[model samples]
Target: MPQIDPNFVFPVLIGDIGGTNARFAILVDSYAEPKEFPVLLTQDFDTIEDAIQSVVLDHTSILPRSAVIAVAGPVEGDEIPLTNCKWVVRPREMMERFNLSDITVLNDFEAQALAVVSLDDKHLENIGGEAAHPNGKRVVLGPGTGLGVAGLIRSRQTWVPVPGEGGHVDFGPRSQRDCQIFPFIEKIDGRISAEQLLCGRGLQHIYQAVCLADGITPCLNSPAEITDAALDKSNPQAVETLELFVIYLGRFAGDLALFFMAQGGVYLSGGIPQRIIPALRNGSFRAAFEDKAPHQHILKSIPVHVIVHPLAAIAGLSAYARTPARFDIHTDGRRWR
Candidate 1:
């Protein structure tokens, strides 16, 4: 997508930087609602600096002084490591190098969680669960280059965002297969985080683990290829691998709902869930989700939604940037460039 500058009073550059690709959009402030549209793919550039330069240079005749970037990695004070990609975005340096008046950096999951606050029914796909009540709290998790997790709580009139590195939490397995699968992952990664078995690379790892367990030669294809074969029912091992993945996703979602006591429901975002929606819809997921002891009833009532909107993070960023008070408080009173 090419950039557009239609002579608006001011335009804020918003970016969602992930391990796979960096998404850039410019939101113009003029009407009650800001105008936002995609500009380019992140892979086209070698670095975040180059990506930003391309966005600004291609869009407007002048450079904007302020910007906000949602990163797909943990934000440790001033530094962040994009889990799936090579660039590290330093906040202070981003400000200085970009010559911007201000910049806000947030965890990618936080941005996704925040975006849920403003999402309507149109942005979601109900995967056999009830809708989240307007007053209910929502949970969002996804497996991309890495698994991401976040919680949204209703704080008075608005939803307050809570970001977490839950993906790094220990992998919990149930039943015999999961029990068998755990040690296999642990042997390879030394420490088996959920992301190791639940993401894109996780998909590949699962495929290999299944093959290794079955005493068959490991598949030589990539994750994408495996998924394609499984969807077509051309590969039994691939289908079985995906089934285990979906079951784990259900169990994890149930666990997260319990942790949050989320009456609102759980949302599965990220790329993988959307691609494998059919596998997710199978009864195995709901069965695993509700397999909780005694408290299984609580888990059953909490609906699960898959975020289908590609620009959901951007919408959340727009909501964040639109709120002047949130911007001021979080930015430590820094002025917008």
Candidate 2:
């Protein structure tokens, strides 16, 4: 069992590091809410340590005694390499450089999974399905710089987060449109993975694929631009691209639900879901989610919710930092506390 230090000092450093931005916070105490710092763009700093120093250390007078960082990558060995960013973080190096007693690093989605159960109705916008089952298993996933997937299981009184590289799994096309788009995606990369069509870059790729299918010139340069065009109904190709993106997202989410038997709920997080809330609420997403034959009824019963909280990962890291025993995380051989 993991032990929590009752006498741990105040001002514990907490961070949620993603490909696009790095969010930092300082926890004064276990009971008090964390004081969040300004979000720092990941590209501004050459290294993860530099980003931390510039954002957290340069701004605050309170030096943290301990740190808990949620990184968007696989946390395996001492070195945690971000999947989307070039910065490779070394926890022990960070501890020594920052003069911290201990540091715990977690997969970004793992932190999100921990935050799922704690989220209230205010932090969520329901997308589909019936009421969420009270104690059933839950799955949390979303598209950002890359796709992130994690499972939450209620083990007795504690919630355990099961983290994996589910984003890199094979992409299965369910519809005729998906079948047509797969070849274009396959041309870019030999095998079609979930991340290739579900991330920020994935959105752009989808837009390009739509243009290719129509034999038209691809005009949009970025995912934001594509979404803008789609929302404004300025470009038919962009609109179709977004529609396909939603269907793929729904199908992929359903696959995850089936794999995890996520009866509690399917929670969507990250940048894409929140930005495209209108598209998600158009009934197409839910319809695609429940299109599976044998388990259509099962999928319909599982509620879908989009996390609206901006700093959910920070809340989760704080929860773990305060009460380590409440979460059953398999750290491999790593000692978090």
Q: Evaluated with lDDT, which candidate comes out highest?
A: 2
Q: Evaluated with TM-score, which candidate comes out highest?
A: 2
- Tens-digit lDDT track for model 2 on 1-337? 9965533455689989998888999998889888899998898899988988888889888899888888998787888788888788888888888898877788899999989977679999999788888888999997999999999999978899998889899887666877776666644356788899999999988888777876899989999999999989999998998898998899989999999999999999988999999999998899889988998999999899999999989888888877777888766544344
Against the reference, the lDDT scores of all candidates come to 0.75, 0.87
User: Which residue pairs collide in model 1, if any?
Assistant: 101-337
Candidate 2 has which clashing residue pairs, if any? none
What's the residue-level lDDT of 100 in candidate 1?
70
Candidate 2's TM-score: 0.95
lDDT of 1 at 313: 89
In Å, residue 161's CA in model 2 sits off its true spot by 0.4
* Model 1 agreement with the true structure over 215-322: per-residue lDDT tens digits: 888764788988898889888889988998888888888889899988788888877889998988878888888788989878878888889887788888777776
Model 1, stretches more than 4 Å misplaced? Answer: 1-10, 30-44, 186-189, 324-337
Tell me the TM-score of each prediction against the true structure. Answer: 0.88, 0.95
